[model samples]
Target: MKALSESHYWATNKKKSKETDQLSPFKVLVRKEVSDHVHSWRFILLLALVLLTFFASLYISMSNIRASFSNVNDPDHAFLYLKLLSATDGSMPPFHILMSFLAPLLGITMGFDAINSEQNSGSLTRLLAQPVYRDNILLAKFYSAMLIIATLFISLTLLMIGGGLFFTGVRIESQEFLRIIGFSVLTIVYVGFYLSLSIMLSVAFRHASTSALTALGIWLFFTVFYPILVNLAIRAFLPDAAYLTQGEKLAYNELIMDIMRVAPGQLYSDGATTMLMPSIRSLGPMSMEQLSGAIPSPLPLRESLIIVWPQLTGLLAGSIAFFALSYYLFMRREIRS
Candidate 1:
């Protein structure tokens, strides 16, 4: 009887301890992940690359704006040039474009080896031996990657804003500042999408290098090659479609182009245009010229948001869905060599 009672007591204690561990396992995991990331050279390289690219692009853009100002005789042209320099809209200078591309690469670099490295080093087994839950491992790595990406973004944004103030001698309005913040948020979401993708690939592959390369390949496909491929496919499938009259055939061609714009880069380009140019209305079904005739006026911010909301929601939803699938797969995967 005493033996059975002692066994029951020990089992109860073990369960309680596990419950306690589960409650705070992610905290320790996050701390360890942050420490590991800070010590890595990749983090430093990513920061350096982002800063250097930003400054270089900013200098070129400012120089071009200054040259335009000097060459223009009309007062209106000067005012227009100044407005372009001061505006934060979709016509984002080269610096913004550079950062958007760089941000995803940075995210991939930070997360591509997160899980596989631990597995390769045999640390994963030891870590799992602890009372920590498996979900904590994934959550901690994700949060750490996000923190690094956010810090890089904030640092670069401040530098750009400071440079704008120093060179342009214009104070940004509160509303414009808010717009910049909104752009940053979208940029972060873009980065997060890639980071989750990298994590998923990291778990899917055995070698860290393979995982990273796979992520890069996907990035290139989506960002660069995918659009070209899509265009070719469309052209092949719809040869002579563009030469068709501006009636039903032209309408059909436009429909095909709209469907193609579902790709992330095209979607983002359209969304950015709407945000940056008050003159832009609907970007999916109709061109700016067409929309202008229908409204004959600039769209309000609310209307602009409504127009692009579908693309934003779709991209965000796709990212979340992909990550959820990855999480489910990782949780169920066997840890065999």
Candidate 2:
């Protein structure tokens, strides 16, 4: 009886070990990546900077919250919770604007060295020598970074909600909550675009610094130089003239906006603005006929989403495309020690 029981125990242990071996590689890689990010000094510093700016924006917004809707009769006054996010004291910009700028840096910092550093340090070869597949490495890194980004943004959103509640003694309505949730998801997608771009650069460039600099350069160009160049090009080519009719001018302005939306920053801004501001009815110049009989009241959550749907789709599609590029590059690259 003792011999039979011992053999049963050994067999059970063996089976469990096999199951563990089968499941461990991908999960272990993801956990390791997440742990490193959480413990790293660079991540710590960036998180602190984000938090500081968040608190400053929150304080400023709370201070001037009442002033944001001074007209008690205004329909927007009903959304005091949202006002906490979009309101600015003119001393500092609102939280979403600050976030739109800083979030990309956070994404870039997390992913700029994801692959190159591993390859440079001679870990990629050994990692692949294990049971883990090449695709698992790239997928684990991207998913882990995205998990961290999602957590950080969700926590920040909750903190903003709590802070607004405490400051104004107003609870968030269902529609307001949904809008905030939409904004948070939009933010994650927006940041994912940068993260994937940086990862793609990391795979394309052998050195981590090169990838980092390239990502920053792209961001700087979009944030500063790209808009200037677009303006210059428009002025030079599609110049608006006094002789142009109202329809022609409107079409020209819309054409400019469509071109500007190609920049990720503009897309994020338009989406964030539309998500946060329920009173904004249209994104582009509307004809007098289209504006006729339109109410000035705040739109429902669904209507606001409709206004920003194209922006959301664009950000999501861009992120996926960049990640796909990174995956392709990482898979085809030679792993040498």
- The candidate that wins on TM-score is 2
**What is the lDDT for 205 in model 2?**
99
What would you estimate as the lDDT of candidate 1? 0.70
Screening candidate 1 with a backbone cut-off below 3 angstroms (N, C-alpha, C), the clashing residue pairs are: 89-276, 90-276
Candidate 1 local lDDT, residue 114: 80
> How many clashes does the backbone of model 1 have?
2
Residue-level lDDT tens digits of model 2 in 42-109: 99999999999988988887888777768666667778778878888689889889987998999899
User: For candidate 1, what is the TM-score?
Assistant: 0.79
Q: Local error of candidate 2 at 279, Å?
A: 0.9
Tens-place lDDT per residue, model 1, 1-337, is 9999999999999999998767677877887888888888988887788777666656555756655446444322333222342333234455545655787787788889988898999889888888878888988998887887787677766766787787778776554555555556666777787888888998888899999999898878878787788778877877585567656575776677676666665666565555554556556455445646573454565787787777677668867876786789789987753
